[model samples]
Target: MIRRTFPILGVLTAVLLSYGLYEALIGAPTEQSMGDVQRIFYYHAPSAWTAFLLFGINFVASVVYLIQRSIKADIIALVTAEVGVVFCTVVLVTGPIWARPVWGIWWTWDIRLTSTLVLWLIYVSYLILRRFSSSGQTPLMAAVIAIFGALDVPLVYFSIRFFRTQHPQPVIGGEGSIDPKMLQVALINWAGFLCFACLVCWSRYRLELLQREVEETEALEALLDSRKAQ
Candidate 1:
Protein backbone atom coordinates (compact mmCIF):
# COMPACT_ATOMS: atom_id res chain seq x y z
CA MET A 1 0.00 0.00 0.00
CA ILE A 2 2.76 2.44 0.97
CA ARG A 3 4.79 1.57 -2.10
CA ARG A 4 1.82 2.12 -4.42
CA THR A 5 1.08 5.56 -3.01
CA PHE A 6 4.38 7.28 -3.87
CA PRO A 7 3.81 7.25 -7.61
CA ILE A 8 0.36 8.73 -7.17
CA LEU A 9 1.70 11.42 -4.90
CA GLY A 10 4.48 12.23 -7.36
CA VAL A 11 2.01 12.59 -10.21
CA LEU A 12 -0.29 14.82 -8.18
CA THR A 13 2.58 17.05 -7.13
CA ALA A 14 3.80 17.41 -10.70
CA VAL A 15 0.35 18.33 -11.99
CA LEU A 16 -0.20 20.94 -9.28
CA LEU A 17 3.24 22.45 -9.85
CA SER A 18 2.70 22.68 -13.59
CA TYR A 19 -0.63 24.40 -13.16
CA GLY A 20 0.84 26.81 -10.63
CA LEU A 21 3.68 27.74 -12.98
CA TYR A 22 1.21 28.41 -15.79
CA GLU A 23 -0.80 30.64 -13.53
CA ALA A 24 2.29 32.51 -12.46
CA LEU A 25 3.70 33.08 -15.95
CA ILE A 26 0.67 33.56 -18.22
CA GLY A 27 -2.29 34.34 -16.03
CA ALA A 28 -0.93 36.45 -13.22
CA PRO A 29 -0.68 40.20 -13.63
CA THR A 30 2.69 41.93 -14.07
CA GLU A 31 4.11 44.48 -11.69
CA GLN A 32 3.61 48.06 -12.71
CA SER A 33 7.15 49.07 -11.75
CA MET A 34 9.37 46.22 -12.90
CA GLY A 35 7.38 45.12 -15.92
CA ASP A 36 8.25 41.70 -17.39
CA VAL A 37 11.33 41.35 -15.24
CA GLN A 38 8.99 41.10 -12.29
CA ARG A 39 8.15 37.57 -13.35
CA ILE A 40 11.43 36.47 -11.79
CA PHE A 41 9.75 36.89 -8.42
CA TYR A 42 7.87 33.68 -9.04
CA TYR A 43 11.16 31.82 -9.22
CA HIS A 44 13.18 33.92 -6.79
CA ALA A 45 11.08 34.12 -3.65
CA PRO A 46 10.16 30.49 -3.76
CA SER A 47 13.75 29.44 -4.31
CA ALA A 48 14.76 31.36 -1.22
CA TRP A 49 11.95 29.88 0.84
CA THR A 50 12.59 26.35 -0.38
CA ALA A 51 16.29 26.66 0.32
CA PHE A 52 15.49 27.64 3.88
CA LEU A 53 13.02 24.79 4.19
CA LEU A 54 15.53 22.26 2.93
CA PHE A 55 18.17 23.48 5.32
CA GLY A 56 15.67 23.12 8.14
CA ILE A 57 15.06 19.55 7.05
CA ASN A 58 18.80 18.87 7.04
CA PHE A 59 19.17 20.27 10.53
CA VAL A 60 16.37 18.17 11.92
CA ALA A 61 17.41 15.01 10.09
CA SER A 62 21.00 15.41 11.18
CA VAL A 63 19.97 15.62 14.81
CA VAL A 64 17.74 12.60 14.44
CA TYR A 65 20.48 10.62 12.72
CA LEU A 66 22.92 11.41 15.49
CA ILE A 67 20.52 10.28 18.17
CA GLN A 68 19.23 7.15 16.42
CA ARG A 69 22.32 6.18 14.40
CA SER A 70 20.00 5.41 11.51
CA ILE A 71 21.44 5.38 8.02
CA LYS A 72 18.07 6.51 6.71
CA ALA A 73 18.26 9.72 8.69
CA ASP A 74 21.82 10.32 7.53
CA ILE A 75 20.80 9.77 3.92
CA ILE A 76 17.93 12.20 4.28
CA ALA A 77 20.18 14.82 5.78
CA LEU A 78 22.73 14.44 3.01
CA VAL A 79 20.09 14.64 0.29
CA THR A 80 18.43 17.67 1.81
CA ALA A 81 21.74 19.48 2.16
CA GLU A 82 22.53 18.94 -1.49
CA VAL A 83 19.09 20.09 -2.63
CA GLY A 84 19.24 23.09 -0.35
CA VAL A 85 22.55 24.11 -1.87
CA VAL A 86 21.09 24.03 -5.36
CA PHE A 87 18.12 26.18 -4.36
CA CYS A 88 20.37 28.58 -2.54
CA THR A 89 22.43 28.97 -5.69
CA VAL A 90 19.24 29.75 -7.59
CA VAL A 91 18.25 32.38 -5.05
CA LEU A 92 21.66 34.01 -5.22
CA VAL A 93 21.67 34.13 -9.00
CA THR A 94 18.10 35.38 -9.32
CA GLY A 95 18.52 38.02 -6.66
CA PRO A 96 21.23 39.76 -8.64
CA ILE A 97 19.21 39.53 -11.83
CA TRP A 98 16.25 41.19 -10.18
CA ALA A 99 18.41 43.73 -8.41
CA ARG A 100 20.40 44.85 -11.44
CA PRO A 101 17.49 46.64 -13.05
CA VAL A 102 15.87 47.99 -9.89
CA TRP A 103 18.71 48.60 -7.50
CA GLY A 104 21.04 49.69 -10.33
CA ILE A 105 23.67 47.42 -8.85
CA TRP A 106 24.71 43.82 -9.34
CA TRP A 107 25.77 43.33 -5.73
CA THR A 108 25.83 45.12 -2.45
CA TRP A 109 27.18 44.64 1.05
CA ASP A 110 23.87 45.54 2.64
CA ILE A 111 22.86 43.60 5.71
CA ARG A 112 20.37 41.32 3.97
CA LEU A 113 22.61 40.49 1.07
CA THR A 114 25.63 40.00 3.26
CA SER A 115 23.82 37.74 5.65
CA THR A 116 22.38 35.64 2.83
CA LEU A 117 25.87 35.33 1.34
CA VAL A 118 27.12 34.17 4.71
CA LEU A 119 24.37 31.55 4.89
CA TRP A 120 25.32 30.27 1.47
CA LEU A 121 28.96 29.94 2.46
CA ILE A 122 27.98 28.15 5.67
CA TYR A 123 26.04 25.46 3.82
CA VAL A 124 28.64 25.14 1.09
CA SER A 125 31.15 24.48 3.85
CA TYR A 126 28.79 21.93 5.33
CA LEU A 127 28.79 20.08 2.03
CA ILE A 128 32.58 20.19 1.88
CA LEU A 129 32.94 19.00 5.45
CA ARG A 130 30.73 16.03 4.80
CA ARG A 131 32.68 15.13 1.69
CA PHE A 132 36.12 15.30 3.30
CA SER A 133 35.48 13.96 6.80
CA SER A 134 36.47 10.39 7.65
CA SER A 135 33.71 7.80 7.15
CA GLY A 136 33.37 6.96 10.86
CA GLN A 137 32.92 10.65 11.79
CA THR A 138 30.68 11.69 8.92
CA PRO A 139 27.35 11.44 10.72
CA LEU A 140 28.44 13.03 13.99
CA MET A 141 30.37 15.79 12.26
CA ALA A 142 27.57 16.49 9.80
CA ALA A 143 25.05 16.76 12.60
CA VAL A 144 27.13 19.32 14.41
CA ILE A 145 27.76 21.32 11.24
CA ALA A 146 24.07 21.35 10.27
CA ILE A 147 23.01 22.56 13.68
CA PHE A 148 25.55 25.36 13.65
CA GLY A 149 24.79 26.39 10.07
CA ALA A 150 21.03 26.65 10.68
CA LEU A 151 21.62 29.50 13.07
CA ASP A 152 22.33 31.66 10.01
CA VAL A 153 18.68 31.57 8.89
CA PRO A 154 17.32 33.61 11.75
CA LEU A 155 20.28 35.94 11.56
CA VAL A 156 19.66 36.56 7.87
CA TYR A 157 15.99 37.34 8.41
CA PHE A 158 16.64 39.75 11.24
CA SER A 159 19.51 41.41 9.43
CA ILE A 160 17.30 42.07 6.44
CA ARG A 161 14.60 43.51 8.66
CA PHE A 162 17.01 45.77 10.50
CA PHE A 163 18.69 46.84 7.31
CA ARG A 164 15.37 47.91 5.82
CA THR A 165 14.63 50.01 8.87
CA GLN A 166 18.01 51.71 8.60
CA HIS A 167 17.99 52.27 4.85
CA PRO A 168 15.28 53.28 2.45
CA GLN A 169 13.02 50.37 1.74
CA PRO A 170 13.58 48.79 -1.65
CA VAL A 171 11.08 49.71 -4.32
CA ILE A 172 9.74 46.19 -4.29
CA GLY A 173 7.97 46.50 -0.92
CA GLY A 174 8.44 50.07 0.22
CA GLU A 175 5.96 52.77 1.32
CA GLY A 176 3.01 50.42 0.69
CA SER A 177 1.96 46.85 0.03
CA ILE A 178 2.23 44.59 -2.95
CA ASP A 179 -0.54 44.91 -5.52
CA PRO A 180 -3.20 42.24 -5.23
CA LYS A 181 -2.48 40.75 -8.63
CA MET A 182 1.28 40.73 -8.13
CA LEU A 183 0.80 39.19 -4.71
CA GLN A 184 -1.28 36.40 -6.23
CA VAL A 185 1.41 35.79 -8.80
CA ALA A 186 4.03 35.62 -6.08
CA LEU A 187 1.97 33.10 -4.13
CA ILE A 188 1.42 30.88 -7.14
CA ASN A 189 5.10 31.04 -8.00
CA TRP A 190 5.94 30.03 -4.45
CA ALA A 191 3.64 27.01 -4.71
CA GLY A 192 5.23 25.89 -7.98
CA PHE A 193 8.77 26.34 -6.69
CA LEU A 194 7.95 24.43 -3.50
CA CYS A 195 6.50 21.49 -5.43
CA PHE A 196 9.51 21.42 -7.73
CA ALA A 197 11.86 21.44 -4.76
CA CYS A 198 10.03 18.50 -3.22
CA LEU A 199 10.28 16.58 -6.46
CA VAL A 200 14.01 17.17 -6.74
CA CYS A 201 14.60 16.18 -3.14
CA TRP A 202 12.56 13.01 -3.56
CA SER A 203 14.49 12.01 -6.68
CA ARG A 204 17.83 12.62 -5.03
CA TYR A 205 16.85 10.70 -1.91
CA ARG A 206 15.80 7.69 -4.02
CA LEU A 207 19.12 7.74 -5.85
CA GLU A 208 20.94 7.82 -2.55
CA LEU A 209 18.94 4.83 -1.36
CA LEU A 210 19.79 2.92 -4.52
CA GLN A 211 23.49 3.65 -4.12
CA ARG A 212 23.45 2.47 -0.55
CA GLU A 213 21.69 -0.75 -1.54
CA VAL A 214 24.33 -1.40 -4.19
CA GLU A 215 27.12 -0.84 -1.68
CA GLU A 216 25.47 -3.19 0.81
CA THR A 217 25.11 -5.88 -1.84
CA GLU A 218 28.73 -5.58 -2.82
CA ALA A 219 29.83 -5.83 0.79
CA LEU A 220 27.72 -8.94 1.27
CA GLU A 221 29.19 -10.49 -1.86
CA ALA A 222 32.69 -9.77 -0.63
CA LEU A 223 31.97 -11.40 2.72
CA LEU A 224 30.63 -14.50 0.99
CA ASP A 225 33.72 -14.72 -1.20
CA SER A 226 35.95 -14.51 1.88
CA ARG A 227 34.02 -17.31 3.59
CA LYS A 228 34.27 -19.48 0.49
CA ALA A 229 38.02 -18.99 0.34
CA GLN A 230 38.34 -20.00 3.99
Candidate 2:
Protein backbone atom coordinates (compact mmCIF):
# COMPACT_ATOMS: atom_id res chain seq x y z
CA MET A 1 0.00 0.00 0.00
CA ILE A 2 2.73 2.45 1.03
CA ARG A 3 4.96 1.53 -1.87
CA ARG A 4 2.25 2.27 -4.42
CA THR A 5 1.08 5.55 -2.85
CA PHE A 6 4.61 6.77 -2.07
CA PRO A 7 5.80 7.15 -5.67
CA ILE A 8 2.50 8.69 -6.70
CA LEU A 9 2.86 11.27 -3.92
CA GLY A 10 6.37 12.12 -5.05
CA VAL A 11 5.27 12.67 -8.62
CA LEU A 12 2.31 14.79 -7.53
CA THR A 13 4.52 16.88 -5.30
CA ALA A 14 6.91 17.54 -8.18
CA VAL A 15 4.08 18.60 -10.49
CA LEU A 16 2.56 20.85 -7.88
CA LEU A 17 5.96 22.38 -7.07
CA SER A 18 6.76 23.07 -10.71
CA TYR A 19 3.42 24.74 -11.34
CA GLY A 20 3.63 26.67 -8.09
CA LEU A 21 7.13 27.87 -8.94
CA TYR A 22 6.01 29.17 -12.31
CA GLU A 23 2.97 30.89 -10.82
CA ALA A 24 4.96 32.51 -8.06
CA LEU A 25 7.88 33.56 -10.21
CA ILE A 26 6.19 34.70 -13.41
CA GLY A 27 2.41 34.77 -13.10
CA ALA A 28 2.25 36.88 -9.94
CA PRO A 29 2.51 40.60 -10.52
CA THR A 30 5.25 42.62 -8.91
CA GLU A 31 4.44 44.64 -5.81
CA GLN A 32 4.31 48.40 -6.29
CA SER A 33 6.67 49.03 -3.40
CA MET A 34 9.15 46.18 -3.07
CA GLY A 35 9.11 45.16 -6.72
CA ASP A 36 10.53 41.75 -7.64
CA VAL A 37 11.96 41.26 -4.17
CA GLN A 38 8.46 40.88 -2.82
CA ARG A 39 8.08 37.69 -4.83
CA ILE A 40 9.96 35.86 -2.08
CA PHE A 41 6.79 36.28 -0.06
CA TYR A 42 5.28 33.51 -2.16
CA TYR A 43 7.44 30.86 -0.57
CA HIS A 44 8.03 32.67 2.74
CA ALA A 45 4.43 33.09 3.77
CA PRO A 46 3.43 29.57 2.78
CA SER A 47 6.37 28.05 4.62
CA ALA A 48 5.39 29.92 7.76
CA TRP A 49 1.80 28.78 7.44
CA THR A 50 2.90 25.18 6.81
CA ALA A 51 5.20 25.23 9.83
CA PHE A 52 2.44 26.48 12.08
CA LEU A 53 0.03 23.94 10.70
CA LEU A 54 2.45 21.07 11.31
CA PHE A 55 3.17 22.29 14.82
CA GLY A 56 -0.54 22.28 15.52
CA ILE A 57 -0.64 18.65 14.43
CA ASN A 58 2.32 17.89 16.64
CA PHE A 59 0.54 19.47 19.60
CA VAL A 60 -2.56 17.32 19.17
CA ALA A 61 -0.51 14.15 18.71
CA SER A 62 1.57 15.00 21.75
CA VAL A 63 -1.55 15.32 23.86
CA VAL A 64 -2.86 12.00 22.57
CA TYR A 65 0.46 10.30 23.32
CA LEU A 66 0.37 11.59 26.90
CA ILE A 67 -3.19 10.54 27.55
CA GLN A 68 -3.21 7.16 25.81
CA ARG A 69 0.49 6.26 25.59
CA SER A 70 -0.16 5.07 22.08
CA ILE A 71 2.83 4.34 19.88
CA LYS A 72 0.91 5.59 16.84
CA ALA A 73 0.34 8.92 18.54
CA ASP A 74 4.00 9.12 19.51
CA ILE A 75 5.07 8.36 15.94
CA ILE A 76 2.75 11.06 14.63
CA ALA A 77 4.03 13.65 17.09
CA LEU A 78 7.63 12.81 16.20
CA VAL A 79 7.07 12.96 12.45
CA THR A 80 5.14 16.23 12.63
CA ALA A 81 7.79 17.90 14.74
CA GLU A 82 10.51 16.85 12.30
CA VAL A 83 8.53 18.05 9.28
CA GLY A 84 7.63 21.30 11.04
CA VAL A 85 11.34 21.96 11.56
CA VAL A 86 11.96 21.66 7.84
CA PHE A 87 9.24 24.22 7.08
CA CYS A 88 10.57 26.56 9.76
CA THR A 89 14.00 26.28 8.16
CA VAL A 90 12.52 27.54 4.93
CA VAL A 91 10.77 30.43 6.71
CA LEU A 92 13.93 31.51 8.53
CA VAL A 93 16.01 31.38 5.34
CA THR A 94 13.57 33.15 3.04
CA GLY A 95 12.66 35.74 5.66
CA PRO A 96 16.19 37.07 5.92
CA ILE A 97 16.59 36.97 2.17
CA TRP A 98 13.40 39.04 1.76
CA ALA A 99 14.39 41.37 4.57
CA ARG A 100 17.83 42.09 3.14
CA PRO A 101 16.60 44.27 0.28
CA VAL A 102 13.52 45.66 2.02
CA TRP A 103 14.81 46.43 5.48
CA GLY A 104 18.44 47.15 4.50
CA ILE A 105 19.51 44.28 6.78
CA TRP A 106 19.53 40.52 6.71
CA TRP A 107 17.95 40.09 10.15
CA THR A 108 16.23 41.92 12.97
CA TRP A 109 15.36 41.34 16.63
CA ASP A 110 11.75 42.38 16.21
CA ILE A 111 9.03 40.51 18.05
CA ARG A 112 7.87 38.58 15.00
CA LEU A 113 11.36 37.50 14.04
CA THR A 114 12.44 36.68 17.58
CA SER A 115 9.45 34.55 18.41
CA THR A 116 9.79 32.63 15.15
CA LEU A 117 13.47 31.94 15.75
CA VAL A 118 12.64 30.71 19.21
CA LEU A 119 9.93 28.48 17.79
CA TRP A 120 12.38 26.87 15.40
CA LEU A 121 14.97 26.38 18.10
CA ILE A 122 12.46 24.74 20.39
CA TYR A 123 11.48 22.17 17.78
CA VAL A 124 15.08 21.56 16.84
CA SER A 125 15.82 20.89 20.46
CA TYR A 126 12.89 18.53 20.63
CA LEU A 127 14.25 16.55 17.68
CA ILE A 128 17.69 16.33 19.26
CA LEU A 129 16.27 15.13 22.55
CA ARG A 130 14.37 12.37 20.79
CA ARG A 131 17.09 11.34 18.37
CA PHE A 132 20.31 11.67 20.31
CA SER A 133 19.23 11.01 23.88
CA SER A 134 18.37 7.76 25.66
CA SER A 135 15.00 6.04 25.32
CA GLY A 136 12.03 5.35 27.66
CA GLN A 137 11.52 8.71 29.45
CA THR A 138 12.51 10.59 26.29
CA PRO A 139 9.09 10.40 24.62
CA LEU A 140 7.35 11.80 27.66
CA MET A 141 9.80 14.66 27.87
CA ALA A 142 9.58 15.22 24.12
CA ALA A 143 5.79 15.24 24.21
CA VAL A 144 5.86 17.93 26.87
CA ILE A 145 8.30 19.93 24.79
CA ALA A 146 6.11 19.58 21.71
CA ILE A 147 3.08 20.83 23.65
CA PHE A 148 4.99 23.86 24.89
CA GLY A 149 6.63 24.44 21.52
CA ALA A 150 3.22 24.57 19.87
CA LEU A 151 2.15 27.23 22.34
CA ASP A 152 4.73 29.54 20.72
CA VAL A 153 3.14 29.24 17.28
CA PRO A 154 0.27 31.54 18.27
CA LEU A 155 2.71 34.02 19.78
CA VAL A 156 4.71 34.07 16.57
CA TYR A 157 1.60 34.57 14.47
CA PHE A 158 0.38 37.54 16.51
CA SER A 159 3.70 39.11 17.35
CA ILE A 160 3.57 41.58 14.49
CA ARG A 161 0.17 42.81 15.59
CA PHE A 162 0.89 42.79 19.33
CA PHE A 163 4.24 44.53 19.09
CA ARG A 164 5.89 46.94 16.69
CA THR A 165 8.01 45.15 14.10
CA GLN A 166 9.81 45.79 10.87
CA HIS A 167 7.98 42.84 9.35
CA PRO A 168 5.10 43.57 7.03
CA GLN A 169 1.52 43.39 8.25
CA PRO A 170 -0.73 40.41 7.63
CA VAL A 171 -1.79 39.84 4.03
CA ILE A 172 -5.36 39.44 5.23
CA GLY A 173 -7.50 41.84 7.26
CA GLY A 174 -4.68 44.19 7.95
CA GLU A 175 -4.38 47.89 7.15
CA GLY A 176 -3.99 47.01 3.47
CA SER A 177 -5.23 44.06 1.45
CA ILE A 178 -3.23 41.89 -0.91
CA ASP A 179 -3.60 42.20 -4.66
CA PRO A 180 -5.99 39.59 -6.02
CA LYS A 181 -3.48 37.94 -8.31
CA MET A 182 -0.81 37.83 -5.63
CA LEU A 183 -3.28 36.40 -3.12
CA GLN A 184 -4.18 33.70 -5.62
CA VAL A 185 -0.54 32.87 -6.17
CA ALA A 186 0.07 32.69 -2.44
CA LEU A 187 -2.86 30.36 -1.93
CA ILE A 188 -1.76 28.11 -4.76
CA ASN A 189 1.76 27.81 -3.41
CA TRP A 190 0.38 27.17 0.08
CA ALA A 191 -1.68 24.26 -1.22
CA GLY A 192 1.32 22.77 -2.96
CA PHE A 193 3.50 23.10 0.13
CA LEU A 194 0.88 21.50 2.36
CA CYS A 195 0.67 18.51 0.05
CA PHE A 196 4.44 18.28 -0.04
CA ALA A 197 4.54 18.37 3.76
CA CYS A 198 2.06 15.53 4.02
CA LEU A 199 4.14 13.41 1.67
CA VAL A 200 7.25 14.01 3.72
CA CYS A 201 5.50 13.32 7.04
CA TRP A 202 4.03 10.04 5.78
CA SER A 203 7.40 8.81 4.60
CA ARG A 204 9.09 9.73 7.89
CA TYR A 205 6.43 8.09 10.01
CA ARG A 206 6.71 4.82 8.09
CA LEU A 207 10.49 4.86 8.32
CA GLU A 208 10.35 5.37 12.08
CA LEU A 209 7.89 2.53 12.44
CA LEU A 210 10.22 0.24 10.52
CA GLN A 211 13.16 1.28 12.68
CA ARG A 212 11.20 0.34 15.83
CA GLU A 213 10.27 -3.03 14.36
CA VAL A 214 13.89 -3.79 13.58
CA GLU A 215 14.98 -2.79 17.09
CA GLU A 216 12.36 -5.01 18.69
CA THR A 217 13.34 -7.92 16.49
CA GLU A 218 16.99 -7.51 17.49
CA ALA A 219 16.06 -7.37 21.18
CA LEU A 220 13.96 -10.53 20.88
CA GLU A 221 16.72 -12.40 19.10
CA ALA A 222 19.22 -11.38 21.75
CA LEU A 223 16.88 -12.56 24.50
CA LEU A 224 16.45 -15.96 22.79
CA ASP A 225 20.23 -16.31 22.42
CA SER A 226 20.77 -15.50 26.09
CA ARG A 227 18.18 -18.07 27.16
CA LYS A 228 19.73 -20.73 24.95
CA ALA A 229 23.21 -20.04 26.43
CA GLN A 230 21.79 -20.17 29.98
Highest TM-score model number: 2
RMSD of 1: 2.9
Best by lDDT: 2
Off by over 4 Å in 2: 1-3, 151-175
- How close is every model to the real structure, measured as TM-score? 0.84, 0.88
User: For residues 1-230, what per-residue lDDT tens digits would candidate 1 score against the true structure?
Assistant: 84776677677678767876787788778777778787888788878888888888899998898789898899889988898889899989998998898778888766656766888898899889989998778878988888887766787778787876688644443326776876776677676677677777777888889987998899999999999999
Off by over 4 Å in 1: 152-175
Worst 10 residues of 1 by lDDT: 168-177
Clashes of 1: 0
lDDT of 2 by residue, 114-202 (tens): 77788889999999989876877878989998887777667776765565545554322122788999988888899889889999899
Weakest ten-residue segment in model 2 by summed lDDT? 166-175
Score candidate 2 by TM-score against the native: 0.88
